[model samples]
Target: MVVGAGLAGVRSVEALRAHGFGGAITLIGEEPHRPYDRPPLSKAVLLGEIDSTVVDSDLGALAVDHRPGVAAKGLRAGVLETTEGELAYDALVIATGASPIRLRGEGPQHVLRTIDDALGLRALLRQGRRVAVVGAGWIGAEVATAARRAGCEVTVVEAAECPLAAALGPVGAHTAPWYERAGIDLRTGAMVASVDLGGLTLVDGSTVEADVVVTGVGVRPSVDWLAGSGIELDDGVVTDEHLRTALPGVVAVGDCAAWWSRRYGRRLRVEHWDTALNSPEVAAATLLGGPGEGAVYDPVPYFWSEQFGHMVQYAGHHAGARLVMRGDPVGTRWSACWVTDGGTLAAVLAVNLPRDLMQGRRLIEGGQHLDVDRLADPAVALRDC
Candidate 1:
């Protein structure tokens, strides 16, 4: 039985069947619709370039019982409690994903997590509408970009000193100017005091008028339903290297699962789409007692964001990495590399540089180290480095 029906849940089902799991597979989803690509919710979907119904894959002929529009109330020993009824399962996959952190305001605050959210926000993004976006993270950045594209006067508020502060360190401050170039009012070190239908109040007693307010602060794992289930929970459902919980017959994946990554030597809870896609394969293998049974769930986390007409791609984590620049950030195209103290490639953030992004992913995955001077030289080919 799979609990989420999101990317991880649906992928787990497909992987199970692919791995020759002949047992009865039941997929449960809280949303009425089947699993769909969520990253596009902030990009093409919001821009009306594509339909909101971005289903990841067709599940027809997959021979699985798909239950949508039902909420999982709780979990018990060897049983799943839902709004409909209890489901008995020999083994279960928990992939409930994560929920956006809502702002403390009375206004029409929005978050881009599901199809419904993107539709609602897109509808309100009329020309010249004052849209105040709180939190200058990836979601906020994308929303601001979309609003600007839709001719809305967008203002982005962030409590951090710079945008993407948590995700990108020294590179974040350099990237902040992109918002201004897109005609967005990028205000860092700004905190939201309150939000109303009229606008929002900042901690500095400044008032910004807005027709819509979107919060992209952060997200927490949707593990409240797992309460009393005896599953360990920190920031997310704690799992071993195999993406298995303390419970023997149960495993967790996706945003809700903080699996131990042997490569990073830490427990990571990645909310990106890549993690959702890859972890399920390992989880499925673990469930069927097959290829990935004893395999570790360490992966080089990859994520990309499209904003301000620049495609930003990042691979790997930047924890304690030595910052290195490949090109001028003030230019139209550049890339940044985060190297470990041991001189190995830890992560790479490239702006409109596809070659750097691709090669950086390979280098990080291969645990390759190169000469710092040569790596930073744009004229030097990445393969040569």
Candidate 2:
């Protein structure tokens, strides 16, 4: 049984079937709608380029019982409690993704996590409308981009010193100018005191009026239901390299699972679409083959975004790694490589440079040692570096 309906949950079902699991499969979701793609909610869906992001999966042909609008309340030995009633499963896949971190506001603040959120925010983004976005993360930047395209006067208030501070760290400052170039009022080191119907009040006792306010600070793993279920939880549901929990016959995946990464020598809980798409196969294999009997769940984390007239892509983990630039940051196309002290590629960030991103991703996965001087040269290919 699967206890979610997002990309991870749906993919888990497909993986189980692909692994020849002919047992009864049941899928449950808290939302009334069927499983849908979420990355588009911030871009194409908000821009009205697409009406829906529902995934094209036929559960009927797969002979799976899909139950929507049923939320998991609790879990116990051999029993899964839901809003409706209790159910039993021989094995379980927990894919309850994550929830957006909301700020302390009273008025109608917008968020871009669900389809309804994008559609609702899209309605408010009109010509001459005032939009104030909190947090300069990926979601915030994408929303600002879409609002600017819709002719809204957008003001992005970020508490950090630069955009993507949490994701890219100090290196994010290099991309700060892009906000101003796009005509967005990018206010760095600005803290919000409160948010109301009129708009948000800064800590400095100033007001930024707006017709709509969005909080894209970040998201937290959705694991409240597993609190007393004997499943360990730290940043998320703690899992081994096989994505298996402490208890047998159960595993977690997607944003909720903090699986151990043998490559990075750490536990990583990546909240990206790539993880949700690829991790399920390893999870299914582990479930069918038992612990440590099949493919492991280690992977090079990856994500991409389209904002401010640029296609940004990143692969691998960059924490505690040195940044190596391939080209000028001011240029139209460039790539940033993160290398370890041992001269191994740890991660890569490419902007409008697909070849660099593709090649750098391969090098990282292959655990190839890179020459620092060659990697810093734009003329040098990532494979050669």
- Which candidate ranks first by lDDT, i.e. highest? 2
Q: lDDT by residue for model 2 over 1-385, one digit each (tens)?
A: 9999899999999999988888999999998888999999999988889979999888887788999999999998788999999999889999999999887768778888888888888999999899999999999999999999999999999999999999998778877888888789999999998888889989998989998999999999999999899999998999999899987889999999999999999999999999899988988998899543668988889999988989999999998899998899988799899999888999999999999989989999999888999999999989998
lDDT of 1 by residue, 1-385 (tens): 9999888999999988888888889999999997888988999999999875646576777888999998899988898999999989999999999999987777878888999999888999999999999999999999999999999999999999999998996589987999988999999999899887788899899998988899899999999998889899999999998889988789999999999989988899999999899998988888888565786788999999998888999999999889889889999899999889988899999899999989988998998768888988988866568
- TM-scores of the candidates in the order shown: 0.98, 0.98
RMSD values, in order shown: 1.1, 1.2
Clashes of each: 0, 0
Q: Report, for every candidate in turn, its global Cα lDDT versus the true structure.
A: 0.89, 0.91
Candidate 1, residue 274: CA error in Å?
0.3
